[model samples]
Target: MDYSLLSQAPLFKGLTADNIVTILSTVPHRVKKFQSGSMISQSGEPVNSLIVVISGVVKGEMVDYTGRVIKIEDIPAPGALAAAFMFGDRNRFPVNVIAVSDGELLLIEKPDFLKLLMRNDIILVNFMDMISNRSQFLSEKIKFLNFKTIKGKLAHYILQKAGKDKLSLKLDKTQNDLADFFGVARPSVARALREMEEEGYIEAKGKYIKLIDKKGLADLTIE
Candidate 1:
């Protein structure tokens, strides 16, 4: 694999070709393939390394004491870090990372990984930026969960999946997944979805959802 392409990543931006190669060479890089629904990291597992997604999507989720699994976030793009829980003092992963599709990951252990960061200030800054972005996203998620109503949260979540105005995006999520994401019962999610469909804000057929009225969903956004 060409390590230079990895340097193009935000986590390695500004690093020289030589430095990138050196870091990549030092790390015991392995390509791990996981089938869909396979758990890459489970809750309470040791946070030994960082896993970078090279292909496909991964979903982070945590299960409650009642055995309810809550889907936290989705990592859809290549070069996105799959496990941010390894960043600091937390040695055990709090959430489970499951493969949303057949995917490949590049794993780098913590000690050597931190050594690489220490060797390159650019890499260190990039790491800091990634953590900062993750923090901001988590804060927003907290607000969304705590303040927004289920209807409002569902609208925003569907909008994110839709991506563009045309809403030609395919959502491979099930009603159960949507329920977990919104922290509601499956019946509640179904009710909310039905309401949205009735209002002509969205159209859902099987695994595909199209946003028919962006403004309608946008208007549902809570303060």
Candidate 2:
């Protein structure tokens, strides 16, 4: 195992390679290998252990009543899966975790994970920060789901991304990725962007978009 890579994990942030080896030397854990396209954990599955990706990429997604797959997000190497739900009474995976590529996962059982946390102040602090940030992200995701139209969702997304200080910004995700994130067809996202531009709300060319009427964009998010 590469201690250097493990040291780069968020939970091990600020720790030296030696520090990670020293800590893990005393912690009981196991490494599991997974293939590409494998189901890691299904939605509502118990998160009884702390599972960290040692390599490759995985995605969290859910299927709606109509069987539409809504992608929550992708978790790459050194990312901990469901770190937020590793504790709490309702500790369960909220989405299906699927491996995007062959990878190895580091598994630390709950009690051992708790012991590891208690043994190191830095690990404990990092764990808490990770959980808090995920909670805030989920809150924003829920807010996005409330919008009834694809245009409305795009409006809220652009405003939030540009923030209060910037007039021009580049999109971080591609249209295909955005469609997955928005839970809509890729053509719908393209149509919505084209419509928004035609309406004088924004000037978009590829990934670059300039907000022409911030108020107009904001209004679209309201209903």
Name the best candidate (by TM-score): 2
> What overall lDDT, based on C-alpha atoms, would model 2 receive against the true structure?
0.92
* Cα misplacement distance, residue 123 of candidate 2 (Å): 1.2
Q: Give the TM-score of candidate 1.
A: 0.58
**Per-residue lDDT of model 2, residues 1-223, tens digit only:** 7778888898999999999889988999999999999999999999999999998899999999999998878899899999988888889998999999999999999999899999899999999989999889778777878998999999998998999999989999899978877778999999999999999999998899999999999999987
What is the C-alpha lDDT profile of model 1 across 1-223, one tens digit per residue? 4455566667877776677777778766677888899988887888787777767788889989999988877875446554467766676777887889987887778887788778878878888888788788778677558636677887777777766655756766688976775667899888887898898988878777778888888778763
lDDT of each model, Cα atoms only? 0.76, 0.92
* Number of clashes found in candidate 1: 0
Model 1 error, position 165 (Å): 29
